[model samples]
Target chain A: MSSFVLFTLTGLGLAGLYFLLASGLSLIFGLMSVLNLAHGAFFAAGGYTAWFVMDALDSVPIGLRFIVALLAAGLVGASAGAVIERVLVRRLYGQHVEQILLTIGLGMAAVALMGGWFSYDPRLLTQPDWFGDTTEIAGANVPNNRLLILGVAILFFIGLMTFLKRTRHGLIIRAGVENPSMVRALGIDVSRSFTIVFALGGLLAGVGGALGTVYFNGISPSLGTTQLIFAFIVVVIGGLGSIPGTALASVLVALTQIYVNNYLTSGLGSISVVVLLAGVLLVRPQGLLGKAAP
Target chain B: MKRSSIFLFVVAAGLAVLPFVPIEVPLLFSGPFDTPGTLQVLSVALVLAGLAMSYDMIFGYTGLLSFGHALPFALGVYGTNLLMLEASIPYVLAAAITLGGVIVVSLVLGSVALRTSGVAFAMVTLAFAEAFSILVISDPLRFLGGEEGISLASEQVPDMFRRVVNTRNIYWLALAFTVFTFVVARVVVSSRAGRVFEAIRENEPRVEMMGLAPFPYKLASFTISSGLAALGGTVYLLAVRGANIGTTSADFTLSILVMVVLGGAGKLWGAAIGGFIYGILNLRLSTVATSNAIDNLPEWLSGPLSEPLFVLGVLFVILVMYAPGGLSSLATKPSFGRATRRS
Candidate 1:
């Protein structure tokens, strides 16, 4: 029973990381109608940025460094997203094949560049000394870092929900998701909204990648491909453009994966989640949370 | 009697006669006309060309992009592998069983996924691919062989094929299959069904209004395309001597779509050319890397500046931006007449 509880908590923590990675992908996909294969590259770049910051400022307070690293990831990812959108993706509007090809190219280029620069060695992200310590809760010991990550993920969700509901830009972005053409007809600066949405999505993915680095204990160049697959599965399972649906689906996927990993096939745990996704997609067609109509 | 048939004869005759001379002596001449390895590579190219032809049915002709086609290809490879290894079946029988399995699986996936359109359809296919890849790599150990992948025993090839199924035999089989598939595809694309697929690509609503179900035809096309792709994978395993998780199945990057575009998407001959180009580039790049020639470049670029990703990426971007019709457009000029524009 205690083992089950521990597994559930671990699953929830992993779900938080998945949420961070997938929500951005969902948001961008909703607004732009573009499958940014390089979204995973942004996630990987975030982890690398955090690694660089942590390694360089050894004397800085560990907690402050972690926060700084998170911010830096968001900033870097947002900037890159903006540049990519303006320079390349802007020209690819309405051409699905072009968008796919370009983003896939960018993703490969990023992987090759990172592999060359990082030399294929995986890097582990360390938590501050305070968070590195373990604590006991409900007769099960959990690491402080994981608890912190969970809290951050929840905070991000609430914050994003509020922003989407209350802010003008957020509403416009939502509107864009519904009908990009309509947004343009209304004389809203749809391009700026696209840029902002792309950056925001990148920022979320970056932070998720950073947190994932801390949880997973290592980051590698091939991390993008692995994470990209996960994000695609999440989006498909959750239904594209549905944020709440994505959140629920992410948790479900994470839980299935965690439990399966521990109890079933071990190394093959993620396979169950993928199978689940396929099953769900088969039944729902549009996705679990997909809109009723196209 | 027909102009096109005469043109085809002339072209075929020229190609068949070209190998008599050394490749360096003429523009069309290629190296070692009689070598087994060359024949083997040509066979592989033919198989890939067949795959590209099928893939282009959806991507180029029908304007539907599918990411899950790789799943059928992988299944085809593993299906044959499993039959030979566990069931102790003959290679010919195994290939047929695998081909049937490929078509059935395609039907199942297409039935559900074809319901969606555009990005949704693409995403669904991707999901299936991920699911299938994971199943093969992880659990379902009975069928997938896990990550290690199932190997072929030397005794599996039939007695009739044993002596002949060497590099040359395999090459001949691949060439025959490619030619057969190309001709069939040419017929299909020029037929009523092909006209429907093209119509759907141009305007789905108009085609639907014209009394075509659209769904059935799309599903049928998807199934046929998938079956051929699986055949390609099966041949690959036989020729390469075995199937691994990565090697047998097409990677997402080089998904047969890349071959489709490289060859000239809508044209069958272009697809074959695309396959040959892909094969030549891939083989030669690896050779170049291991060769001493890479030593002269800068330290950063010295190590294999000829990565397929770089070539593919550049080609993809350029083709999408400029020649959306693909490379075959440059050669065929189907839409343009000789005296109209070019001097």
Candidate 2:
């Protein structure tokens, strides 16, 4: 029972990272109708940036360093995303194939740059002293870092939901997702909205990557490709442009992956998740929470 | 002869004589190709051309953006290798079996993948490919040989594919296979079903409203495309004398896509041209990067720049941004003729 609880917590912690990664992808797809394949590059950039910051600020307080690293990651990711959107994504509106090719090319460039800059060796992010400690929860010994990640994920989920539901900008984004032409007709400047959404998505991915680096104890240039595939699966399974759907789908995928890895072989875990993605896509093309296209 | 047939004949004639042609590169442009290297690169290019044309069949003609194309191609390679090496099957029978397996796998994958359209379809195919790759690398059956992959000796294959004994045989085989693939692709694109594929691409709903079932046509195109891709893989294995995990990787799939797009999608000849350009560029660029040609640069700057894939990535981005229509468009533009007509 304790092991079960422990596994479940581990699954939820992983699900939190997936949620952060997929939410941005889902949001961008919903608002801009652009499947930003380079979103994984943003995640990778965030991880690498966080690692650099942590190394540079080694003399600072551990907690302070952690916060600074995360913020830096988010900022760097957002700026990269903004640049990509302004320069490339803006011109390829409604051209899915072009967008896909462009983003994929950009992604390859980003990964290559990372490899060139950082070398191929994986780097470890130093965890804070408090984060390193373990905590007892419901008779199960759990790592405090896992609990912290879970807390952060929940907060992010609530914050994103509130932002989307309550803020005018969020309302505009939702409106744009539903009907871009209608929003444009109302003088919302859909292009600007797209840029903002893209930045925000990048920020989320960055934060997720930073957190993931600490959790996984390492970061590498190849992280982007692996995480990108997972994000794709999550977004597809959850539904294309649905935030709530993404959250649900992330939990489902993460839990399944964790359970399979723990109980079965690690290789089977990846296979199972892929199978799950195929099954979900076949059964519900629109995804669990996504609305059908008109 | 008809114009198209004449064009085909010219292409075949050029390919037939290409291996015998002595390529002389100036000192400034000298990198990898001497003579044998050029032939080897040309043979690989021919195989890739076939692969790229197959990709064009689905993505360009059928309007299906499948990300798991490498699956069928790799399956063909591994299937042929396994049948010949392990099962001790004859070359013809093994190839036939591999083709059969490819068709069955394509039918199964296409059925599930075609349930979704657009982005969902791409993801679903990717998922299946990832699963297949993982399984192959994991090698639970032990036949896959894990990361070591599988290699076949000259004795394992038929007389024609014995690269060790006679390298030119494999080269000719690849060239023949490439031409065959192009002809088949050309026929399909000009056939009645090909018209339906284009119609579906332009507007699926309208075609559906017209009482034409797009699903069957798509499946047929996908199956045919997979078969061709498998054939390319067979040629690749025979020429290279091996199959590895990289054959089924996402990178390989993306590379095939890049070749198709760079040649201009929906054009069979364009894909072939694009494949040749990409293959040649990749080989030459990598050779240049590693050579002492850029030794003047600082270590930090030269280290990354020396990698061919990085250069390719930058080129890919630039090409997509500036010339999304690919190299084929440049050749077919008729800009000079248009200017003269305007004058």
DockQ of every candidate structure: 0.36, 0.49
Q: What's the lDDT for residue A280 in model 1?
A: 82
Q: Residue A207 error for model 1, in Å? A: 2.2
- When candidate 1 is compared with the true two-chain complex, its DockQ is 0.36
Which lDDT tens digits does candidate 1 get at residues A208-277? 8788788878789767677677777788788888888888888898889989889876756676876786
- Indicate the docking level reached by candidate 1: acceptable
C-alpha RMSD over true interface residues, each candidate? 5.3, 5.0
Best by lDDT: 2
Candidate 2 lDDT (Cα, 0 to 1): 0.83
lDDT of each: 0.74, 0.83
- The C-alpha stretches of model 1 lying farther than 4 A from their native spots are A59-61, A119-121, A126-133, B1-33, B139-145, B159-165, B247-250, B289-298, B301-306, B332-343
The clash tally of candidate 2 reads: 0
